[model samples]
Target: MRLYEFEGKQLLEKAGVPIPKGFYVTYSAMGAVGADPELERIFDELGGREVAVKAQVLAGKRGKAGGIHFADSPEALQQVVEAMVGSELLGETVTGVLIEEKASFEEEYYMSLTYDTVARQPVLAISREGGVDVETFAREHPDKLVLRRFGPIVGLMPWVARDAAAEAGFRGRELRQIAAIAVKLWRVLVDNDARLVEINPLVRTADGLLLALDAAILLDGDARVRHPETNFPPRQATGRPLTERELIAQAIDEGDYRGVAGKYVELDGDIGMLTSGGGGSITLMDAVAAFGGRPANYTEYGGNPPAEKVYRLTKVVATKPGLHGLLIAGGIANNTRVDVTFEGIARALEEIRPEYPIVIRRAGPGEEEGLRLMRELAQRLGLDMEVYGADLPMTESARIIVEKAAAYRQKVEGK
Candidate 1:
């Protein structure tokens, strides 16, 4: 949920923070030759010195990825834009570029606000060593990093901001100015329900002007309702764009549900798992680990996912080369048909039919019928599937799968 530089700068300007002038253009238009005729007008009006042509992407580490460049002349600007316009960024093709006036930075400073899940509040971070990555700076030069936690109820206060600036070695008027800006940014975060608002290289010019050289903003998806202007249009995995189904699921942030690609989350011990429901999937993983077995993934079918989606999910889970066994588990179901989950697993197993052992522990509503249906389906498909009754403790079922898989692997490997 990282906003592009243009978007970040727009938000910062509205918050009364100083920012450089910039213009954004998508690559859909023709190349430099076609674009120059129109861009010349702006170049003439703005007596700006250096301009930056930055590639817009959701991913970070853009500098490392060569997504940013500087242009000293108008011709150089056109060359940089032409070279960067249609290029792919880490496999996602560049759709647009942000052209901005570069700042004559004499000194760089860093400031940011991030949510602390454990503290259940926001943490304000600032450093004197600014232009570089904050994490690296904090690690190598820990003394320069100053962090203060704000209470969730009170948000950030002016006094706390002053203290943070003082710790970062700022003095007198400069300290007050930077700290006041920080307080304002924090206020923006609280009002806008932002997960993070960061300004790296908040620069001070030789002429004594403070400005933001770059900004990063991450909006809280849960609080998107509060910010109507920030909604992202739906898109697909190949980044071509998303269909209706992808959009529906993308609304929720789930570690269990990945993009179009297969999702696998490693557990402590050694049991490959496929299950549905976020709460139940996590509990199953914990239970498996608690009993000395590992759940290979945190994957779920999501809300009433269709057969094809389940089949697609299982195909991903069952085919993993590292998996020792499989534990298909779920909680008491009210609306989700047990038969659909069972069928998805059965079909996926039938397709791969790896020698790995599998134990299915499913129940609740349509229990008797679903169990019978899966049993018949497995036998007809010439599959060796272990179906456990609902009464069986989930912990016991996971242990059984682990032991069976171990024995099977050992027998096959002659170990």
Candidate 2:
């Protein structure tokens, strides 16, 4: 779960991180004109400081993409606020703008705590070069990068925090100040069960005060059960709304067995795919696309998904009207019998009996039994089926599906 910028800022503020002063404005209560009075009042309360108008979007690179702007004057600020509110960023609409006082920067730094995939643990990263993409900074200037591993049992200690800042080129007093804040940030990361806590432009003032210019935080949904106070607002997709199936899949992550298993995502293509195994699916998708077939979906039928479950999911995929083909390709897992998956496939073929071209590539445990069942079913129903053996690699299977789909498309277009 990802918290909106405002929510994340609230948490940061509570953790003693100095953030720019800002307030959120909603669309319904006030048109930009109606909100003028309140805005003026806040501006007056702030004693005349330059402000920033930023669109609250989920994705990053907002600044480069014109999602952020500066307004030195009240009129300029109002114009920016008016332009941003109700606008869309990427594919997500902005409900409001974060009106914040601009900070005077003497120096900028980057800091973040994120789960490290390779180590399978949380890692803290810091850099003296700030306000830019952290990944880009890490890649371009490896020497400026400072990384520290955090253990699950002890979490991030004061000594580790000080060392991280020192490694980022901070000296003496500055290192001490930054290190204290880093310790606090670690506490926030752990106590809140956050997946990420990033301050990309942590700034220092001429007077030696440090503050966060921007913040982005991602909550660990798996740990949300423990934190009742955490909240996320409704995220409207910027372009078209998410499909019903996508929303259903998104909602399915509330309990045990909740993670979205299999590689499944919606795409703007003509073939619905249900391939299994990680490497096999990747190989097959690339092959399918390379061979001129546009996949309508990406799915994986994992080792022995319950027959009924697979049948139900297949029925869902079959409902896509634009679907030109279905590809069921994957290397059979050594441990799971192919017959289990075949049972589901057979049931789905009977249940949907979709008119679109269907392609199958099967191999693995119970390969003979699975093929026999598919062949028997095809014969009994008088349905034309294409089932291939696992002797062919995933790429070949994908190419066959793509070629078949292209032929189908040509035939339909000709008709």
Among these predicted structures, which one has the highest lDDT? 2
For candidate 1, report its TM-score.
0.74
Off by over 4 Å in 2: 26-49, 72-78, 115-122, 150-152, 233-241, 248-264, 277-280, 290-292, 301-309, 333-352, 363-377, 380-382, 388-396
Best by TM-score: 2
Error of 2 at 291 (Å): 4.1
Cα lDDT of model 2 by residue, 124-223, tens digit: 8888899987777788888898888878688888899888998888998989888888877887798899989998889998788999888888888798
Worst 10 residues of 2 by lDDT: 254-263
lDDT of 2 at 213: 84
TM-score of each: 0.74, 0.81
| Colliding residue pairs in candidate 2 | 91-238, 92-238, 271-296
Worst 10 residues of 1 by lDDT: 258-267
Clashes of each: 5, 3
Root-mean-square deviation of candidate 1: 5.9
Deviation in Å, model 2, residue 12 alpha carbon: 1.9
